[model samples]
Target: MLKILKYLKKSSISVVAIVLLLMVQALCDISLPDYTSKIVNIGIQQGGIENAVPEVIKEDDLKKLMIFIDANKQSQVKDYYHLIKYKDTESDSYKKNIDKYPALKNENLYVLKDIDKDELKDLNELLSKSEMALLTIENNKNQDNKIKESILKSFPIELSVKMKDKSLIEIMEYLPKEKTNAIKKEIMKKIEKMPDSIIEQSAIIYVNKEYKSIGIDMDRLQNKSILKSGTQMIAIAILSMFVTIIVTFLAAKVAAKLGKTLRTDVYEKVMSFSNEEMKKYSTASLITRSTNDIQQIQVMMVMILRFIFYAPMMAVMGIFKVVNTNVSMTWIIGVAVLFIVFLLSILFTFVMPKFKLVQKLVDRLNLVSREIITGIMPIRAFSNQEYEEKRFEEANRNLTKVNIFVNRIMSFMMPSMILVMNLIGILIVYKGTYSIDSGTMQVGDMMAFIQYTMQIIMSFLVIAMMSVMIPRASVSASRICEIIETNPTIKDSLDIKTFNPDKKGVVEFKNVSFKYPDAEEEVLSDISFIANPGETTAFIGSTGSGKSTLVNLIPRFFDATKGQILVDGTDIRDVKQFELREKIGYVPQKGILFTGTIASNLRYGNRNATDDEIKEAADIAQASEFINSKPEGVEFKIAQGGTNVSGGQKQRLSIARAIAKNPEIYIFDDSFSALDLKTDAALRKELKRKTSESTVLIVAQRISTILHAEQIIVLDEGKIIGKGTHEELLKTCEIYKQIALSQLSKEELGNE
Candidate 1:
């Protein structure tokens, strides 16, 4: 994972922005719970108001309260004094004013009590006759009053008089305990029996005057709070969504660019590889590494960007909220998160090693599939289709089984997470309900706790999900790194020098020996030869006699293991491979072509070739005849590997491609093997004239192919048994005589 991070260094600024945005998004999410708590605790239960003044009080009680209210400079103290100052003859006017200031009811009660006993009797008789109506008032405060100012005010003024006259211990003695107790009981009973209608009228009057005086509406304040919080939540949600979309797009772009860079790097590395390096990783495996393996890394990169940073930040912020909630239930979240972590750790431990095997299996599947497609004709001819099918099915089944196992294990994750989340919710509700009953926590607070707990759990859940992908992506990253890190065994030296000789196209092998990697014996041994400029040198041998290997060394496809190969009389190793190859045109045993028009393939080695040069090279290689037969001619599209063309046609086009380069040295490694006798003779005849001033090295199996060469070398079992012209070799060399007699009549050899 850390190795992969190096590639992301260029995207650091964007990454930091994504993280900051994610943190902002998390903070917004956390704040929602607080708003929800407010709506529940203050909005629904408390009716959106916090403080209310009393609507009714007794005259003596009001006077006592005024003492404290005066000290505090409370505006309501004037209302209290009004209630006490107006009584008796003004009681009816006060009753009329009670609707506006019902707090004066205490003064009316004092007036009723101080009335002449006979007059009080008459008033009681008038109330019993139901002639008077009850005054009504209402209080709108949401909060219950903690300080009972009404009760404090209702205490007897005589208690204060007694306390001022004597010490606290002597107060009861001076006042007479029996009289004080009787008066308190009687007054409390009368206050408790106050009519609901009268109290409601008083409360309404008190609230209206207070609100009018303060110049504020209680309902508006509550509405604004709810609206403000709701608006903030919506704005944050939209911002979070916007950030998510932008981050997703940026992450995808970064992953794609990373994949592109990696693929180009791998391709450049493979292009520079020699035969030994190519052998280290097969063609099919290299294809998988550059494509499927890199795709895995790309996918992992997206997940890392989208979730890896976001999850941890969310989790940290969630933990912060939980700690600040000031509750013991926070430990419940910790335990739940730890359990999730343990579950994921166990699953990843079992699955990570298998991810490496999965890529290898894919490589094998590709190898089998490619071979089956390329060798379909041969498989049918040999009646081996069933064997191939069984082979492919077995590999497919192995890959499928592993994928199923991994998928099955991962399927348990979502369900387990849900279960853990629900269990935590149940536990919180159990504890929260008790707290609510005890008045320690509110419904809104409990709801907020549940949401925060889920947030904390989900953070770990995101990490758990990523655990599955990281392992697979890590395996793919390692595979891609392998190709990039591989140092090609063959490379030009830092002090590479240019090769210049008096005569060009002179290729010489000086006591050269060669062996394939891990082979027990050399394929070619102690070979010494020179093909001078303006000459054609041909090699003929039984299969595996190093005919192709010997020529392959000239272009530095592989360097000589035991000796030196010289091009233009300078050691080829001293020159850069690209510079050395530019001087030679090589046609392989298998004629390969890319997906393009014939003209494009021909121009591959020399892009500056003119149309005339393309036609001239095609005519010399005898490919012009077939090419002109097609309506598109040289513009005809060739399928990859030239699969659309016949073997002989492909060979002709390969020869034409080489000829287009017009190199000083030309090598034909069994290039004529696919051609018939007539076409082969025509091509060689034309090539001989065209390359008269250049060196030509030909590897052939047929004696007719090399009959007129300036020199013919006969090889057997990695060693040269004969070297001379055909006529001289027939007379002196037995190996040459055997090969020549097999393909020609004795009279034919004599004629030559």
Candidate 2:
């Protein structure tokens, strides 16, 4: 919540607007009970009602007031000022919904007359100009406006032909037409025989007619007790509503604001870690912490702001009213509340531990679901679909069972509170009736006390509900905090001198070594090499030979744990990461892409890259063939991860992304694994020709792939046991010779 407060401070303007809206709504809600009390006790009881509203109020003014109250009951309805004032609600496209159904106007169903004339005119005009009717007709027939109008109008016509849901068919079936008038006349006589006072009271309460309008003497004004009580209810209702609104709005925002702040902090902290530290925690865990944990905190904050807050206020106010209203029956309300609290506490203590367990299980279930979706193809091929399905089902069932149990326990509070409250009510009424008969209490005073007693219990019930969620939210908050506090092991050193881009792309590793965090063995050991400008250096080894790891060091994606790497004769440790990576272009083995146009992905490497430059890069990477084949050409859309494209195509596109940047150094980490031999050779030939001025580093498994390299380093495990050209390596290096022998005979090797 504290973190959320920080965010609220930044977005304080929205918070304030929301608070103001809620307050208005709360005030309106509060006023309703008061209005009810006023009409019942003040106007109806007296022979002459005294209270008056604005003179401009119409005969049905009470109904209008009620309607307004109902509308104001919704907090969102009260938020209209925010939307209207700022124009930041739904966009114009969504708001102008009437534009899509022009024929709705043609039937005279959607009338032009409205309370707001400007609104009516604007609505009518919007309906007329929009081609919505024609647009929705399956794209073909919809364009034929005449057919569209006929189709749309026929439905309402079919319904209007008969009495629909408003049918009075049953009464028409049972009653004879001639007898209906006779029956109604007799009913009217019975209604007329009702007491005159009842008639006057019902009229003032339900019909909004004043005493003068009804021509009745208003003696109801003298019963000031009911009138005062009712008026106080209205005022209190209004006050409660306003305060609740302000509190709730601020509360909801606190959750959202906290989530955003906490998430941002977690991201910033994770980013701060050096590459070495990043590898320690899984990406999935970090994502869960930021999204799920923060979300939990957010949800809790909203509940706390809205419901939890109301409980205590109600308890306090209810107690005051209940006790002060009827001093003798005070113990009843207090004892009932105490019982509720004790029951709630016992329930919470038991449920709190379960809620924590439930959250952990939720996290696990989410993790498994994500994994299954991501590896759906593998699961199918391996025939583990049933296994995964059963696994998920079991997890789901357990989660459901636990939640149901928790809810079962939680659901107890409300009903129990209401029942206990009712029992207390019975006793109060029994005792109050005696007081009233003995001339010690008034009927209205006893009624007010009962109302306050109910409120006190209700407040506790609200607290009970909030308590169930609090434990879970607290756990989530702690999880989020842990993530936010984690410092990255690899980060930019403060005060480090950044790399200068003007220097040639010369890279060298001096006795470089690396070990995975907390691992037993080194992945790269005592490796020393250099690649100068205008040269192609390659590393070749079987899988797990640290080929990719070696290239990863160049961009500082993973720093060497034990040695120094220099770029342009300056140690990379002295350079800022942004300056170091800007000069390097890398294409990884797996081609990762986003949901966007090809143009967008291409421009990600260099935001300012021109269309011509993109095309050239595409041509250089052997991707132009497929890209031009697309209907939109470079504008062709790529689904997330390039799932829509073929493996070979995705790889080429990834290469093109790198080429578009035209950086000083190019690192291809087995980037051509998906390409066909013909395209691979062509791509390599093009790269060699076009990128002669830039340093090139390639990691490969195929010997033929790196045969043309100026320097070939043969690695086994982490150690660079051999280094030379293809000919030199074949003659001197044993591992290289064995690898070369596996591919060719002695004569073929000699001939090469």
Candidate 3:
């Protein structure tokens, strides 16, 4: 995890920003439980109804609130009865003061609808009844006072205190308090001081205010607790989600980048090695390292981004929370966790070695699959479908058998974890009963703790799940690293100078010797030879005679261990490998081709090769015939590895690729083995004419193949048995004489 983090730190700003986002998200998530505690203790416990809200809803502005609707109609009727009598007296006074003519303000006039005095009195009686019910509910002294204030604010003070217009909420806020008694006395005095006629004839305005969250009454113990807990959990969940996404994305990006970088490094290292060195590791193993191993590492990185911090934090915090409960049940859970770890650890320990064997088996299976596909033509020609199938089945069966066993072992982990959890759950329930009886635990507290315990156990289970992949991926990483760290036996010169490839070709071997790594004897011993401008020097020998190995050195595919190889009088090593290789055109024994058009293959040697140059090269290599047969000509698409083309066509195309380079020296290591005699003869004729100014080296099995060469070298077991013209070799060297007699007619050998 640390290593992955360090890699991500290479892009510090982005990583840090994402990490911050994750932290913020986690903060939100953690806030949930804490908020739950608040809701339970404060909102529900206190019965803050005005602020109370449902669990699913979110409103914070709500405070103590109530809505009182109706007023006391009975009190209004009694007041109306008195007001009629007072109004008669007021009317008499008005008549007496008519001469004074005092004007009435609109505020003092009646705002109520006109009604018969008897009907107005009846409505007042209903209003008084409604007010009594409201006041009756809030009969507490404190409540009455608040109700009195609610009415004063909701209505005109004249309407509320005088009982002219009333509100149920105002009555609801009414508390039976000492202050209520004093306020009521003062209100009665003010009402009496006003004429009763004014209260009976006039109406007043009042307002009712409502709060949605507060309306639900979260102040109740159960409701408030649930609301607050839910809010906190929601906040926590949001934070967790935010943190998870940020971390997972960042970790995945970093892991992918590292994988790509590691891939590049591995490729460079492997590419630096010669053919012999490349043969040391199988292709499947290399692929697994690049893809499978990298993916495993990538997954680990993703998890670390999301849960690395969370896993440990949850484990530790859960432990603390659980332990603080101080219930006797702690030991049971601890033992269960320990047993689970031990069981899983043991299971993994036994399976790890078998998993490695599975990887090897998979490599073998891939090798077989590759061979069957590559050698499809041979397999079909030999009618070996069943034979190859059996081989493939054998290899595949070995892999499947081991993989099944691995799956079987792995399959046990989750169930075993669950089983352990269940057993521990039983113990917890049993122990929880005792704690409850002893007052060491509450029902809700035990419920929450049990939930937390499950979370802790699951986290460990997840860790165990991830641990299973570690050993296999570790092996793969080591394998990949090993390749990347290896120093190639062939290395580029540190101090290289520019060189030209246009000079007259004169390649010389000065007692060159080379031994493959881990081999007891040198493959080529004391090989000293020269091929000058406008000449062909061909090597002919039996199998294992170092023919191809000898030509390989001239190109520096592998450096000679004991001697110097020079080109144009300068040591080839000092000339720079690219320049040295650019001067020599080589065609290996097996023609290699990638999936592409004919024109693309021809351009492999020189990207800048023109159409005319490609045509000319194709003509010289005898590839023009097959290429012209296709309707698309140079645009003809080839299958992967040249599978679509005939063996001879593939060889011709390979030759054309080298020919397109038009290098100073051309090396053909039995590149013509697949061609027919007529095509071979035509190709040689074309090559000889086209390469009149270039040196050519050929490694062949047939004497007829190199019969017309200016010089021939024969090898027997890595030593030069003879070096002369073809005729001279048939007479001078016994090994060459045997090879000549085996491949040539008497007439051909007689001239030799």
The number of the candidate with the highest TM-score is: 1
Q: How do the residues 557-582 of candidate 1 rate in per-residue lDDT, one tens digit apiece?
A: 88888988888878988988888889
> Measured by C-alpha RMSD in angstroms, how accurate is candidate 3?
14.5
Q: Model 3: per-residue lDDT, tens digit, 18-130?
A: 66765565445434444543454334433332121111111110111112212333344333221212133356543443232222110111112345757755654443223
| lDDT (Cα, tens digit) per residue for candidate 2, span 605-670 | 899999999999999999998888989998999987788998888888899999999988999999
Error of 2 at 611 (Å): 1.3
Q: Rate the local accuracy (lDDT) of all candidates.
A: 0.75, 0.67, 0.68
The model with the greater TM-score, 2 or 3, is 3
Report the number of backbone clashes for model 1: 7
TM-score between candidate 2 and the true structure: 0.71
Models ranked on TM-score: 1, 3, 2
Name the 10 consecutive residues with the lowest summed lDDT in model 3: 57-66
Q: Among all windows of ten consecutive residues in candidate 1, which has the lowest summed lDDT? A: 129-138
